[model samples]
Each structure stands twice: as C-alpha cells, then as structure tokens.
Target: MMKNTRYITATVLDGNRLEIETPDLPIGQTIEVILVIPETLQASLTLSDRYAFLKLPIAERQKVLSMQAEAMIEHYENNTEWKDLMTGDIVEYSEP
Candidate 1:
C-alpha cells in the first residue's frame, strides 16, 4: 500500500521515454512531455537569461536539448527554482 507522499525511491536510468514514475499509477497509461522552448530563444542561442541551453555546461546542455526542454521551473512554482544540477552540483531532496 502507499504509505505517504514522503516515501519514494529514486533511481537513475537512461532511455528515450520520459523517466517519471509517479507512485500508484498504472504502468501502461499514456503520458506526454512537451518541449516549449520559444522560437525567439531558439533563433538566438547565443543569449543568456532567455536561452537556457546557452547557459548550461556541454553535457548538461546536450541532455536539456535532447529532452527538448520545456518550461522554466519558475513556471511551475513560484518558490521553487531549478538549480543547475550539472553546473551547480547541488542536489536537493526530501527525506522519505
């Protein structure tokens, strides 16, 4: 049974599909991930602050681009910020 929201197991794997595994969801259900990088930003890859790809490290930039990265973390939650896991080398996680 599902214990609590705090209970979770994180693993690292690489593949084509999205790696999200929310607890209790049926395995075969369909999901979607959209890359909404603005065209203006795409056209101006040299710019920072607006274009995230230009600001990231080479490897991280590859992953972000490969994923066709979408919205900035700020778009989801006001208080939450997407720290550059590659550049910052800072990992933030909650105890389960």
Candidate 2:
C-alpha cells in the first residue's frame, strides 16, 4: 500500500512527548512519525566564526578541515546509505 508523507517540526515537551498541531491531519487516522533533529545545534559555523576561520594559519585550517571530513565520514557511515555515482544505486557501507 502507498502512504502519504507529511513533514512537521515539533518540540519535545516534558516526559519526552512531542506536541504536534496540524488541522489538515484527520483526527483518528494513524500516521508514521519520523523525527529529524537539527544539526545546527551541534556543528554549525556562524558568520563571525567564518571570518575568524579564514584568518587561521594553514596548518590549523588543514586540521579543522580534516576533522570535519572525518566527522562527515563517521556520520554517513553510522546514519545513512551511500549512493554510488557510477552505478546510481544506494549501498550500505562494508569494511574494506
């Protein structure tokens, strides 16, 4: 069976409950819920930080870039499937 998907942003309330208010949704219909947390809270660079980042020495900048690349690799390995550009298919990571 095909399903309709709707995206809604909700805040977690006390006791780990999410309060969602949407008039378009039916009162008694069952729906699947997928929670996507924002990444800005963890690793976002602000405008002022961007200026400071540009002023960093070459070695420091390379270190920062390497760290970010590792973080991206780790995040993708843990939470997502990789898309193979040559085959145009999604594949799970397997250790080489």
Candidate 3:
C-alpha cells in the first residue's frame, strides 16, 4: 500500500527530464510521477531563452544551467518555501 504523497516543484534538466528532491524512499519501492508544466514555464522554453542562455559566459551560464538531482536535493534541503501539503501553510523562499 502507498504510504504518503509529497509534492515538489522542480526545474527540467535535460529535455523531458525533471529534477525533484524529497526524502529517500525504500529501495524497492514502486512510485508514480506526475508532471504539470505551467504556461509561464512553457514560455521560458522558447528559442529566445535558449539563445540568451547560449550567449552567457561559461561561468554565468553554468549557474543558470539546470540542477542535477543531487544538486536539487541540496537546494531543497536548504529551501524555506517548501509547503506543507497537510496543513496548507506556505513559507517564503527565494533563489539566490
């Protein structure tokens, strides 16, 4: 039986891949993944953003690059904006 559900917001890494952070699950656990891409996020996926990103210096560009799973988890660990699904409370967090 399923234990609990957790909601996470993450950025897409490479094409068609999402990076999210949560507590570790059992080694052999079976889970489902559902993605909801917002329209604003879709707009950011356009050629202009790609071009702008490409124009950035390597160092700056790397900063904007998508976070890997490990990095995403680290970011989540330090994040204050993580919402509570049970109580519907919101904590403010801003990316550095």
Q: Which one wins by lDDT: 1 or 3?
A: 3
Overlapping backbone residue pairs in candidate 2 total 0
* Residue lDDT tens for model 2, 13-72: 999898888788789978655344345663565788678778978866775676567657
**How does model 1 fare in lDDT?**
0.49
Work out the TM-score per prediction: 0.24, 0.40, 0.33
- Candidate 2 yields a Cα-based lDDT of 0.67
Writing each residue's lDDT as its tens digit, candidate 3 over 1-96 gives 534656677776788677765559776678765443454565658798678668878865543343234446766789757745447557899999
Which parts of model 3 have CA positions greater than 4 angstroms off?
Answer: 1-3, 41-96
List RMSD in Å for every model shown. Answer: 17.6, 17.6, 17.0
Q: List the global CA lDDT of all models.
A: 0.49, 0.67, 0.61
Alpha carbon lDDT at 27, candidate 3? 63
Q: Weakest 10 consecutive residues, lDDT, candidate 2?
A: 33-42
lDDT of 1 by residue, 1-96 (tens): 332222233344676433556866687856433344455557755556546546667865665554443333434455334534336556799999
Where does candidate 1 have its weakest 10-residue lDDT segment?
Answer: 1-10
Error of 1 at 84 (Å): 41
